[model samples]
Target: MLRRLVLTAAASVAALSAAPVAAHADTAADLGARAGDRLTVTVTDAGEGQDGTFDLECRPTGGSHPDPAGACATLDQVPWGKDPFAPVAPDAMCTMQYGGPATAHITGTWHGRHVDASFKRTDGCEISRWDSLVPVLPTTAGA
Candidate 1:
């Protein structure tokens, strides 16, 4: 019957659409397993003995960073759906007080995406952003 034929065609279409979604999920998992995650962080003007470039790797965590374990743990704690390296919103109000003369640049892949984010401690918002990463960006507290 025509009805039976139409139903079969619709089922085939649905299965075909679902196949791509499943394939994409599998590919993403494979990529994660193979590539893992890596990052290169550079800091300047932090203070005495706190300025340099460091490598950080996660999902097994080993690199040249001073505290790779702590840095990875801090990064993992970031809430899902939130970007840890995102810049402060332009409309947000921030304190005018200066935090310090420190600046940092972080570049590499995270969560399968390329990242090149910058951090500074010029004001309240920027300082807060810098502090959130903790060991990843040397603590500028009381500086």
Candidate 2:
């Protein structure tokens, strides 16, 4: 009986050990661990019939970005979501007037995740979003 009990206990231990352990990725650590990556940014101004493009490598902050440090800082402040880009506030109020034909397209990997985001100054809220991403986009809002 004692031998049977020991065998049962050993079997239970084996079963427990065989159970799969779920491993969760730590976001902050994962992001921090990545080497800086390339980001392609393009800005369009319909009023001027012009489009500007820039390639940026953030994190360590390099590339043609006007102010890589500031832009990366702004991006770093945002919390990571399953979706690469967080949704703008639904309850946010925006002005009706068109801020102009300023549009920005950003695509690449950030924090080891693929990112594709578009920005436009169509309203007050959108303008805010565009302005907040300054240097990341261009600085020619008035033009």
Candidate 3:
């Protein structure tokens, strides 16, 4: 009887140890891009109303972005950054000029992580960054 009790106790201990702990549940759930309800993006042009606000949801792809398909495709290319645009090369030079007063804020989830990108057209670099994310951000009527 004692031997049987010891065997049962050992089996119970093994089962308990092998079972996943509660602490890792949340971590496991957030492991990666979950389908059906995993992606969303919001962009505000800082202009004013509807023209400025572009909210998007990918994974099925839908939202206010002018070109949802194109915009989502572009977003797929971004890795992560305060700004997702590639940096200017060390030797390369950017023109020194003001593009405009238009600015934009992008925040949401991409892939499986958070995304927050800021854009402005104050200077050459700013203009490039802003323009680079087109349809995601609308183009001005003229220039």
Q: Quick one: best lDDT, which candidate?
A: 1
Candidate 1 segments exceeding 4 Å error: 1-17, 20-35, 141-143
lDDT tens digits, residue span 21-90, model 2: 3212465556565576668988888345336777888756788776678777777666655443444678
**TM-scores vs. true structure, each candidate:** 0.83, 0.66, 0.57
Q: In candidate 3, what are the lDDT values of residues 68-127, reduced to their tens digit?
A: 888777766676544454444457567877765666667776555566666666567667
Each candidate: RMSD: 3.1, 5.2, 7.3
Against the unseen true structure, what C-alpha lDDT does each candidate score? Answer: 0.90, 0.71, 0.61
Between candidates 2 and 3, name the one with more favorable lDDT.
2
Candidate of highest TM-score: 1
C-alpha-based local distance difference test score of model 3: 0.61
CA RMSD (A), model 2: 5.2
Estimate the TM-score for candidate 1. Answer: 0.83
- What TM-score number comes out for model 3? 0.57
